[model samples]
Target: MLKTLYKGFILSYLLITISCTTNQNSSDLIQAIDNRQTDKALRIIDQLDNLNEQDSLGLSPMHWAAKRALPQITKALIKKGCNLNITDVHGYTPLNYAIKADNAEIINLMLKNQAVVYKNGLSNLSDGPFVDWTEKGLYAYYLKHDSISSKSFLLGKFINQNTRYFKGWNGDTTTYTITDNKIPAWEFKTQEPIFVLGDIHGQYDRMVKNLQAHGVIDKHLKWSWGKGHLVFVGDIFDRGNKVTEALWLIYKLEQEADKTGGKVHMSFGNHELMVLNKDNRYIANDYKNLCNNLGLEYNTLFHSNSVLGEWLRSKNSMTKINDILFVHGGISQKQIDSGMSTQEINELVRQYLISGSSPKNQDKLNQILKSFGPFWYRGYFMDRSQYKKITEQELISILEALKVSRVVVGHTENDELSALYNGKVIDVNIPLAEDSIPNQALLIKYGKFFRLTEDGNKTLLN
Candidate 1:
């Protein structure tokens, strides 16, 4: 009895020892792959019994190897009996990671290994990561075959603003088209009434009703506010779906408004910046599938090659109409210290999006991408204690330095339009997704400011 007990205890101890060693080896393997220390990684990987072990995020060694395009490491794992068909928490296989890396060589290698992938580029919201759209499409049928299931979004299936329908996909076409012409803007010196609306947040009905009531759009959703400057101060994507519908409407209005000497502008919002940088948490699935069909990520969909990407990338984080500065998020003193003029800032941002964010301008780019940058500054609205506090004089000084009488911003949501810093800072970010009531817009005629509601009523903010 004593000898039997000793043997069982020794066996249990060996199993625990092996488990601990294997876990450590798996972590070390991942680091070596990421650090390009292939030699050390190979040493550690040889000690592992399980090659398909996932991290807390459900990414295995194979996923990392594929993302890094380490062909040798990938092959070694395959030889060691790693499952190529295993999906991560987001349902992305190694094939998806390879597609994101844009490594055609790795993709071919995976194909050679008989790798299978998810269908339709679809994943349940409750599942893993949203479609990992890099400059390339999602899993399977990418540039492989026509008549793919992903093309369903490209048809006339999408609902647009509850009034119009959009035909997304066409069989055998290089570019898809919407049936309407419209587009997105802001002001000039000493001229038309400048209309600034705050965050749309995919509430199409609220946007249209407010615009139509204010004579911005007719019942048909055409640009009716002729020669008027209309601006969406940012946060037009995410939360509710219909982002594609909202964006298309803005695009169509931009074209129509330009024809009649009017302007439609979308200032850079943080949400837009986030999506442009590839955070797809709030991204609509239909949008993702469409992005897949085009062999592009959500960001690259509006890349320099695509007209929509060009237009969106060309938009400024901050704009000046006469003197009042309009930005999606407020600008800080730090943004000014970057020593970039508004035009220069816009150019820099455009350059960053078109070209990859490289090392040379990385510092400047990092500063701009920070929370305090123009499209993300909350110092002006948040209680100075929590974020950063500014005296009224300090606020005026900041505006004066930029040569603006007042500043208009969206992002800091309030129950209604608000005038802070004695009207020097006008926050137009109303709660669009929450309130059923149609919202108001900030109207500037000459130098005076007023809140214009959807009921044709006006409230003096001065």
Candidate 2:
């Protein structure tokens, strides 16, 4: 009996020792995977048989490899029969990591092993890193395909799958025929006037109020006033709780107008470009929250490839109707003298507007910025005399070359209502402050001369 008991004790001891050793080896392999030591991880994985050993964080070696984006290590672990469906602490499976990392080879391997694509798991809100990886993977997949239809489909899928937190404004779905001619026939009619709306800064309530006052919106949010040829002078975002709502509403209106032979002309604004560049960090928290609610990481929806950003980039800096020139900011003489045609200037504006935070080429970007700066200048407008002081007759020469009686702009905020400068330019930034009398927007009727007045009243220019 004594001998038997001693033998039993020895067997228990051996079993414990083996278990400890196995656990230690598994931990070492996990550490290798975590450190992205792909070869070492592979070698360690090869020594294991069960492949079910969990790391300190309870992640399997395969999960570790996938999180680290070590494709080779993942492949080796797969060869060792690592479960492709094994999820980490955050509920992200190995395939999730592979997709997020843009590791197509590893993704293919996991998919071949029957990895799931859409699984309802624990929320990834706290797992910022993993969420980032996932977005990157989706973006990469779209990039790889590179077809407009494919891209649109993939983006819709991504939004549908992820962005359920906030209400999305789907622009009016009506398809409008693009007028193939130079200018639409409706633009020439004097009786049908076009109303130019200044920067809206996401004040949706104010926008609705102004539009309603101008007979643009009815009580039911329907278009009822003017010819519907509303020129929105950009800066539709930042500084308000309703930017998304405003954008969606405007997008719908734009589409509606287009369908009815009306139009919504937009000029690129600096704030839109600032957000596009990600330089001005003081973003509206509501907008940020909207992105988070949509399951998009911060900066994800406003990046270089963002739909809004791309659309802004494609807009013309200025529009010429008859003898009048409409630009968000006035252009300088140098742009005209560079032997650039109107089409070339428009293309240049597009390039500057689209080149986000870190431009692909610095020197090329600088050249573009210098030329596009005229239509994007704010400081120069603060001191008109400084234009001559800095550029030394260059500004005047450019203005003369453009040859319009007056350049209409909306960048400088004027407290004294509207300010006419040099008898050649107009600054129509309406002050929306409570202490000040409400200012007005300038409306130039197609066949009639220029006029300015308060929101509800009109005064003809003599």
Best by lDDT: 1
Per-residue lDDT of 383-408 in model 2, one digit per residue for the tens?
45334322425545555666555556
Show the lowest summed lDDT stretch of 10 residues, model 2. 124-133
Residue 303 alpha-carbon offset, candidate 2, angstroms: 3.8
lDDT, candidate 1, 206-231, per-residue tens: 88888888888998888898888888
In the predicted model 2, the residue pairs found to clash are: 100-133, 333-398
Taking all chains together, each candidate's TM-score versus the true structure is 0.62, 0.60
Candidate 2 local Cα displacement, residue 309, angstroms: 3.2
Give the Cα-based TM-score of candidate 1 against the true structure: 0.62
Worst 10 residues of 1 by lDDT: 124-133
Over 4 Å off, model 2? 1-29, 37-191, 286-299, 352-368, 378-386, 389-400, 416-419, 431-439, 446-455
* RMSD of model 2 against the true structure: 10.6
